[model samples]
Target: MKVVETVSGIRETLANMRTAPGKRLKVGFVPTMGYLHEGHQSLLSKAKAECDIVVLSIFVNPLQFGPNEDFDKYPRDSERDLRLAEQSGCDVVFMPSVQEMYPNPIRTSVSVKGVTERLCGASRPGHFDGVAAVVLKLFHIVQPDKAYFGLKDAQQVAVISQMVSDLNVPVDIVPCPILREADGLAMSSRNVYLSAEERREALVLSKALGMAERLAQEEGLTFEALRNKIEGEIRSTPLADIDYIEVLSYPELEPVDPSMETVSRTSDMIVALAVKFGKTRLIDNVILHRK
Candidate 1:
């Protein structure tokens, strides 16, 4: 229930806790924008279970969103987020303002070269750079023993992992499973933009992934064939416009060559898709182990 608005305030509070503590306090941190949802709650619940203290940060990072993107309209409810964080067992809520986090112009950013070149990165230029910079800043600010991120943003997870390893950030980056709605839509704060019809159309992303999974599992289909099928499914939905459909090697995320049978046999594949429903872009993916 305690909300610390300034960065200095958070630092002071944590310092006091560190000095008074008998044992070294293990803190788990979940950094997010201020919209509380079941997906975020899932992360907090896991953090609470594992760590002695849980810190949830609710700052709508302006740097992460492009000029045309929804930075201004991004849903924010600090009061609601605070209550939910408290209910989910978070000890401290860090709600720093834009000015507080970015006092002067930022010069440097963390960027993972290969992984940041495809999927979401391909479409949105400088998106991952912004994500990397803000996340690094948050890690420095919170200085938690462990930090948690949802797997819904698979590429983001990969990028962050790479940054942490390269930079030697002294925290464990724990990736939790993707939380989905009962209807199978991957939970997202941006899901609010979907209207009644667009909402129905949005399911195509997951459905296409399901089709790819079936093909990969049952038909013993090649990566190219499976990717084609996924793309076909998305195109079939009138409201859906395909952005990118790729089956890449897991973790490294390099595009797999299905023509080379040996590559398919040796590699674990991941099918990832990004499609635009009207103006809202949605992403979904499924991982398959080649037999």
Candidate 2:
């Protein structure tokens, strides 16, 4: 596996990939803020199985983080990240510094309007703008045939997909399902900052997701009822600081009104939640298609 820390270096690396002996290789890209876990590995694994070469970029994007967010405290371990990248069948790893990514003051920013206005975007203003900007930059840099993203950040997936479609970026956006731990916490890079007690309490997000599925699908509860049940469960523990417990239409991310639908079942809906355990903020969601 090759590690290129500079833009010129990574571009030079990929220039060779396209001109290789056999037919042009199809590249799959996975962009991550490093702290390699099963969640990230899963994207690389899927990309490896499907594409000729998998390129993984590990850069903690300052753009995607809010002013008050944990950008500095966000985790990093290059030695371990590289080892895991190689294990996950990654061929090239792009590990760039913030200065390298944004050499000059970046005046250009990318934003997806409707999708960015709600959920995570509403709370953390301009968060998706940073995400869209960086992802687009990587897309141009790698120019992969396809890119892989985890559905754990369904809002993010929705935003990027919208950006790709609206901008007519030629790469396919492949969103994989959420990968969780044995007891069901949605794996995140920030999971490292969590205390042992907070780690145990973190399962509430997953449990709430489970409850979300059962209540909405089987019981066909109203949006208010579904929200109440999930909120009640997460609030059962004092440590789970509730940020938002939203039941809304998927991809579009507009809130579903109980008065309009009677029951929460709609076309394709998402049960999304964001909660803080100590200093670590965790988000999880379940996507359901109409039956």
- Alpha-carbon lDDT, every model: 0.84, 0.90
Clash numbers, per candidate: 0, 0
| Poorest stretch of ten by lDDT in candidate 1 | 258-267
Give a tens-digit lDDT track for model 2, residues 251-291.
79987775556453548888888999998898999987776
Q: Which ranges in model 2 have alpha carbons more than 4 Å from their true place?
A: 264-266
| Collision count of model 1 | 0
Q: Pick out the ten consecutive residues of candidate 2 with the lowest summed lDDT.
A: 257-266
55: Cα error in model 2, Å: 0.2
Give the top-scoring candidate (TM-score).
2
Off by over 4 Å in 1: 261-265, 289-291
Candidate 2 clashes between residue pairs 3 or more apart in a chain or in different chains:
none
